[model samples]
Target: MNSIVTLNDTNCPITTSLAIAEGVGNPHASVIKVIRQNIADFEEFGNIGFEIQNSISGAGRPTEYAILNEQQSALLLTYFRNNDTVKAFKKALIKAFFEMRDELNKRQAPAENLSRMDILQLAMQSEEERLRLEQEKLKLEHQIEEEAPRVAFAKQVEAAPDAISVAQAAKVIGTGQRRLFAFLRQIGWISRRNEPYQTKIESGYLDVKLGSWDHPDHGLKQSVTALVTGKGLSKLQKLWSERDQDHAA
Candidate 1:
């Protein structure tokens, strides 16, 4: 195998070099000495002192360690610019850099590694499974369609209106007598007219505007605060914000 394949690149040579310098502790060290030390550190310890913080939250101590604040990090970046010894150390860490990065990633979210081809294969498998499910769904839909007419006819007779006879109410509702009675009774609209053609109408109970079917409101009406929370409240807040922005704009 090519040794270069196992090497890190020199993208952040300055930082790498400073790490070496910091570890070995010599401001005026030779480039080769710094490089050797950093490489030896990698070979021996498998990583620099940087610790990755664990992402998953539980009772465990954080998995990755953090080092250096903004000032220290900035200094490290600047050190790479004027320091040849640091550059050499960075060059030596190139191979291990990628491996270290992968390890850190796995520690954060473990999963099997996948090549491009492997990902493509899995995607294709998912597509095939989805298509199979769709075909089965379509076949089931066809079966439902074949049985629908008879089922509908039976239901229609059962649910036919019992309140006022449709023929008598036709003129008042501006529809045909037969059709009007059928419609009104099915919807539970009683006649206003009294017995012996009393023509008394019962009040309509269904609120069609709320939803598709005759679903009753059922309980006491409440304030908006009771209905919204978390994401729902967030969405309402966003809508109000957008409205305000529009007015401002």
Candidate 2:
């Protein structure tokens, strides 16, 4: 191959004017003279990189030459009149440049594959983070919704309004009467019959009073009823929040 082509430091394929002269069977000084004269035209493709080379005759000053890429090479070839030798060398040079490019692409294939894989991995991670942040945002919105009612209830109870019936307290607490009754029993605040325990009543969390009602068959009758005081409302709210957190955990 007569070392037809090689790569520059930047990995670009280049041939020197000296190599062009050798390939075309021209005098090296003659080729240099042509390049120096037509340099402005050749520079239209790109800057022509000049370098001093070892003197061919191993005497006198070193020979000066211009480094050229494929396009610059084509332009330089136009300056020389067509000949069989020059034509043959042009074809060989074209083949040599193409072979160098193929070699470079083959060598870089693994690195290119790695770069594409890295990009894909980064994209996947970004998507995962986006999804995670979206889920957290939704969870926060749900929590705010749940807290809104509880906040309103807290403000109302702290104002210490008159004692209200257990049923009314259930409505303010955002639960059904039966559900509150069951929960009160579970925490031993009341009995299975849903009446406030005497200890709780004395502690000022509840009140017990006679509720009289008329029956169809019987005369007026009286039974004990439970009511929630303001303090009890506040405590129930706290307990309800704790229960929800436990369930979530």
Considering every candidate listed, which one attains the maximal TM-score? 2
How does residue 122 of candidate 2 score in lDDT? Answer: 59
Residue-level lDDT tens digits of model 1 in 1-249: 212222122212123333444533455234323334344433442334332222356444322222332223333334455466645544544434555456445434423677677777766875776677678657755643443321222111121133233243334334565553343344333222211110111122111111123336655432110011233223333554565588799
Off by over 4 Å in 2: 56-58, 112-249
Angstrom error at residue 90, model 1: 63
Looking at candidate 1, the ten consecutive residues that score lowest on lDDT are: 194-203
Per-residue lDDT of candidate 2, residues 1-249 (tens digit): 336787665668889998899989999878877877787888888888865444458564445567998888878787788899999999999999999999878655554566777767756865776677679657755643433321222112122246788899889989899988888888877766666665566567776655579989998975666678898888888898898799999
List candidate 1 stretches off by more than 4 Å: 1-111, 114-117, 139-146, 153-249
RMSD of each: 27.7, 37.0
Question: Judged by lDDT, which candidate is best?
Answer: 2
